[model samples]
Target: MHIKERLFGKTAGKEVMAITLTNRSGASITAMTYGASLLEWSVPDKAGKFDNITLAFDNLEDYVTHRPFYGATVGRVAGRVAHGSFEIDGDPYQLETNQETNHLHGGNSGLDTKVWDYQTEQDDQEARIIFSYLDAEGSNRYPGNLKIQVTYTFTEDNKWKINYQAETDAPTLFNPTNHVYFNLHGTVSKTILDHQLFVDADRFVELNEQSIPTGRRPDVAGPPFDFRTARLTSQATESTHPQTLQVSGLDHPFVLNHDANRLDVSLYDPQSGRKITMKTSEPVVVIFMHNGASPLKIANNPIPAYAGITLETQDYPDAINQAHFGSIVLRPGETYRSETTYSFHIE
Candidate 1:
């Protein structure tokens, strides 16, 4: 195993560092400290060739200027907060409406843009990198001073594990997730429409016109939202189902089974014979097909809709607003923890 670090760039007078972790399987993951974001993930294909499967920029400037989350670690809250307003303890708080009418990914200048402290280590067993960030009190109009820590580990078995821990000094909302867009076809030009996906979910959250959750978990056994069984990605997108037309692609949260250490989702690309098995401790997973408009280009290549797939695991969007969904509130003495693992293999 090998771990290396280099000066990536400077953000807000702070130095950003890129750390690379390589395991015995010749698989590697590169992460930057600027946003505590993943820059690249190289895995072996069936042909024994390794290729980066995630969308990445060539420089830090592209990530800073681009609106696409890319491989960012989204925080404060991972998804929307419903009109950017939420009441806690009888007090109303309003957040930045970065996503038009709702608060998206913790508003503008969220944790994804801030510099984080990082530590790296490589042992005979695996290579790991841990990132830590502190959100000051009322930094983003939310109460409490929050401290967050996330660790990324690469094992010899080709498993990538992400562990998150957070605590707050006052009652506040805390939900963080890694927004890593994957293109397992070995290239960004290829769309993931042909990939086979299986999500261990029976119900999915319905969305409104503005992409806000309606606080309903409709059964996914039918309609365009169904993924109860392994199915080709195109089957859902090509249909005229109302939910399918709403986002131009899939972009809703799926309720995950409560079984711990069990597989939550599986994405397989037949073209490259690469498969990814993911397990998470979260209750919901939002799978986005990247159907929105974007001018951001990665590696000098224009990124089009459906170019990548983002499987974000975290608390459901607007959990604070909808008490029935689940509680995302973190009190002063409580600790928040989440873990997600992606095991890579060739089928």
Candidate 2:
């Protein structure tokens, strides 16, 4: 395995660096210091042809202007917090409502937009990059001083692993995920409708019109919600179910039936014969069939809706308010850790 670093661009007067880690098998993953975002992942298909499978911009200017969250490390909390209001040890804290009335993706200036310090390590079997950031206390009105580290490991066996660790100086909320959209066909011009997906989940979090959880975990026994078995993504995007129609596709958080030894999710594209299986320690995986309404472009071409999909593994959204969703609270003297791994191969 080997690693290379190059100047990506300048953002906020700080130089952003792009670090590429290549394994012996010829698969490579590139990450950027800006937002600690994933820049590219090129892997071979059945024909031994390599292509970038993640949807991302070709330059830093687009990332700075569009803020699509593409491949970025989402943080503080991965999903929406109801009205940006939550209490920590009886003290109520209100965050910026960046998305309508909800606090989406850790407020306006979340971890995804921050530049992080990084360190790299390489061994005979793996290449690793660790990005670290310090979230000052009271930033965006959140409590505690949070020190977070996001590590990406590329192994010789074609496994890309993400490990998140955090520590807080006071009571705070911490749930993070990588917003990396994958289109196995290798291009954003192609939609993921034809890809097959399997999620080991019996239920999914119900969301309101505003996309905040309704505190309900609806059973996914039939139709669009049922992805227990491998099914075409078109099955969900083309469905008329209210939940599917609400957001134009599957954007709900499916509560995982966790098993340390089992792979919890898999996505495959028949045409390219590229498959990715995921295992995570987190309790939920938010499957977002990219139904972006923004006028976006990549390679100077217009990006269509459903061009890619995200499998965001993290704790439940708005867990602080939903008693059954479990806790995301990180207090002093406590350390928070979560991990997710993706193994790639030809089907």
Candidate 3:
């Protein structure tokens, strides 16, 4: 395993770098200090031809200007929080309403847009990069001084793992997830609608008109949301179900009943014979297909609707406000940790 680093660009007068980790199998994953964002993931297809399967911009300017989330690590909180406001211990907190009137992806200036301190390490079988960031108290109108560390490890076995750990000085909420859009055929693949997806879930978080959770976990057994068995994206999109009609495609959180760590979701592209297996410690996984028009220009090409899909592994949305959804509160003296892995191979 090996790692290579080079200047990516300068953000806020601070130099940003891109680090690439290469395994023995000749596949590599490159990420940038900005957002600790995944810039590329090159893997071999059934034909043994290596291709970059993750979507990203060709230049740094696009990332700094647009909020596509792309292949970045999203949080302080991953999903939405109703009305961009919440209460803890009877104290109210207001967040930036970057998406409508709700808080999305940790507000406008979240971890995804931050420049983090990163370091690379490697052993005989794997190469890993660790990114560290500190979210100052009241920085985003949120309480608590939080210190977070996220590590991405690539092993010779073609496994890419993300490990997150955080600590807060006061009671706060935290849910971080890598928002990487994947298209197994290639980053420039026209659409991911041909991909087949399988999620080991019997239920999904119900959403309101604004797409926020309604504190309900509806059964998915007979709906288009039922992805317990592999189903083509095209086939799933054809349903006239309310969920599909509202979102225009798959964009809901699926319940994860597995143990702390095990495979819970998988996606396959029959044309290229490429497949990805994802496992996480989080309780749910949000599947989001780029449904509407995206202003992103990735790889110097215009990104259209349904170009790629994201498997955001993390807690449910608005968990803090919805008691039934569980808690995302991180109390003092507690250390929060979560792991998610993506393993790639050809069928």
The best candidate in terms of lDDT: 2
Tens-digit lDDT track for model 2 on 1-347? 98999999998899999999998888999999999999999999999999999998879988888789999999899889999998877888999999888899988899988999999999999999999999999887788899999999999998999999999988999999999999999987789999999999999999989888999998999989898889999988788998889999999999998766657999999999999999999999999988864587777767888999999999998899998888899989998988999989897
The runs of at least 3 residues in candidate 1 whose Cα sits more than 4 Å from the true structure, single-residue gaps closed, are 259-262
Model 1: lowest-lDDT 10 consecutive positions:
292-301
What overall lDDT, based on C-alpha atoms, would model 2 receive against the true structure? 0.91
Worst 10 residues of 3 by lDDT: 293-302
What lDDT would each prediction earn against the true structure? Answer: 0.87, 0.91, 0.88
Q: After superposition, how far is residue 117 of candidate 3 from its true place, in Å?
A: 0.2
Give a tens-digit lDDT track for model 3, residues 106-182.
88899999999999899999999999999998866778999999999999999999999999999998988999999
**RMSD, each candidate, Å?**
1.3, 1.0, 1.4
Q: Which stretches of candidate 3 lie over 4 Å from their true place?
A: 259-262
Per-residue lDDT, model 2, residue 77, is 90
Measure candidate 1: CA RMSD. 1.3
TM-score of each: 0.97, 0.98, 0.97
lDDT of 1: 0.87
Top TM-score hit: 2
Q: Sort the candidates on lDDT, descending order.
A: 2, 3, 1
Per-residue lDDT of model 1, residues 1-347, tens digit only: 98889999986788999999988778999999988999988998889898899988868887887746889999899988888998888988888888888888987889998999988877888888999999998776878999999999988888889999999989999999999988998676778999999898989999999889888888887757787688988776898988889888898899988666557999999989999989998989999998864687666677777888989999888999897987899998898998999989899
Cα shift from native, residue 23, model 1 (Å): 0.7
Off by over 4 Å in 2: none
